[model samples]
Target: MRVLTILLCLLLTGTPARAVQPDEVLPDAALEQRARDISAELRCLVCQNESIDDSDAPLARDLRLLVRERLVAGDGDREVTDFIVARYGEFVLLRPVFGLHTALLWLGPVIVLAFGAVALVRGARRRRQEAGTPALTPEEKARLDAILGQD
Candidate 1:
């Protein structure tokens, strides 16, 4: 039981294996670190939600290589990111930039919610108004009562 517990603990506590292969590692520690930071910000196109740093997909590997290449070519972090964004479109970044182009993406849900709330309030008010007043006129009420043999 103790051996099993120890194995379980090791398994749970072990650091996750990185997807970057040994051949892909940069010689310069600083550049490698920057590449890692950039990779973490980039979405793996094939893996959807996973960052390129964590993804094991072939596209993720290619993206990692591209980042290293850009860094070696003396591109600044922003420039590297922009290059990727230009090639893959805005979806390459895990967090999209807030700008005129993306304003609708950021605000669309709130706008939809506001419209839904207005429609809901209007519908409730209409239902309440409909339910509050009786439809029968005095003559209609009298006729209904006479048909039911009520004096």
Candidate 2:
């Protein structure tokens, strides 16, 4: 039991649990560099926030391979990117294209900030109005004064 426990610990120690993407062995350094550049601009669909080059997902590996293949096949950078974009939509690009469909993506945060600002202004105005109003009525104040035996 002690030996099994020691073996298990040794096996599990310092080994990365995340699966690594397949390394593309490019014939030319320049082609590999281009592939890396393009991959860096592509977002991994499985890991939405991570670039395809950085993600360990199987899908990311496939996309990385696809990019390298296209590069080796003499496709220009723009052509390779366009091919992926056409296949996966603008979501594949780390920075999406500006178009009617993506207007919301570009404007969403600004719209939210504007709405929050309006809400804050309205809330502040409401608070000011409430603060200016007397908490107790004149009659109530008078009653309280009388009850307390004060003028």
Candidate 3:
């Protein structure tokens, strides 16, 4: 019953556990909100699949603090994001910007889809041709006649 109740409560609350400690929160609400927004855009290096705001890893905590520090330093959202990207490279961004460096990353899925579609069309055509009729050679025709006792 306890476990069931606990699961029920967890299902009702969908937000993931945040890594931010109370001490890391700024007194300024607006600055804290900006820091949170920035943190949400950052990928946690220790947990590549999670945003720094959602990850509970130590590196995620550090990243959250760094975002808060940048906000406190009066840096705008873009400036803070660029500063982190400059330091960590583009991998730190959860949503990578499209550019020459990331062109393959952006286009690879479309290219694969196109190739898959072409292969499906070719396969369907081959199956259709095979299903249509048997193109028998002269020797095969004689063999068929022998098998049918018509030779």
Candidate 4:
């Protein structure tokens, strides 16, 4: 039973199935690796969340082929990536480049965090102030005492 469980775990956690076909694999090992690396960084437009390497979508296949084609054409990694970015826009990149255009994407989290921290600090200060002092003024307290005495 333990051996069966171990086998199941190994099968489940083993290398994930890739979408790359045997025909799609380049003969040149180095170029094929580069193509694969590039494919892994490209987002599949159809899948939206999956990389081209993992997605079975036709667009992902096209992108994979395009990457291989670019490699075969002697384009460097950066050049191939630039070409894809130009053709498909930066949204196709799994990891987007930080620049003026993508500034919000890169900085929005930090900005939100900073704003939340400021709000938290302000909230803590307000809570401390409230805890330190009486909620009512001296006159109000005197009025309350008089009312209670009358009652």
Among these predictions, the greatest lDDT belongs to: 1
* Residues 100-146 of candidate 2: C-alpha lDDT, one tens digit per residue: 99899999999999999999999999999988958988999999999
Better-scoring candidate (lDDT), 1 or 2: 1
Worst 10 residues of 4 by lDDT: 142-151
lDDT tens readout by residue for model 1, 2-44:
9999999999999977899999999999999999999999999
Clashing pairs in model 4, backbone N/Cα/C closer than 3 A:
none
Quote each prediction's TM-score. 0.70, 0.68, 0.82, 0.82
Candidate 1 — what's its lDDT?
A: 0.96
Against the true structure, candidate 3 reaches a TM-score of: 0.82
lDDT (Cα, tens digit) per residue for candidate 3, span 1-151: 9999999998998776788889989999989988998999999999899999889899889888888888888899999999999989999999999999999999999999999999999999999999998899999999999999996
Q: Could you arrange the candidates by TM-score from highest to lowest?
A: 3, 4, 1, 2
- Report the Cα lDDT for residue 100, model 1: 100
Question: In candidate 3, what residue range of length 10 has the lowest lDDT sum?
Answer: 13-22
Question: Which clashing pairs does model 3 show?
Answer: none
In order, what lDDT does every prediction score?
A: 0.96, 0.87, 0.92, 0.94
In candidate 1, which residue ranges exceed 4 Å CA deviation? 1-17, 133-136, 139-151
RMSD of 3: 4.5
CA RMSD (A), model 2: 6.3
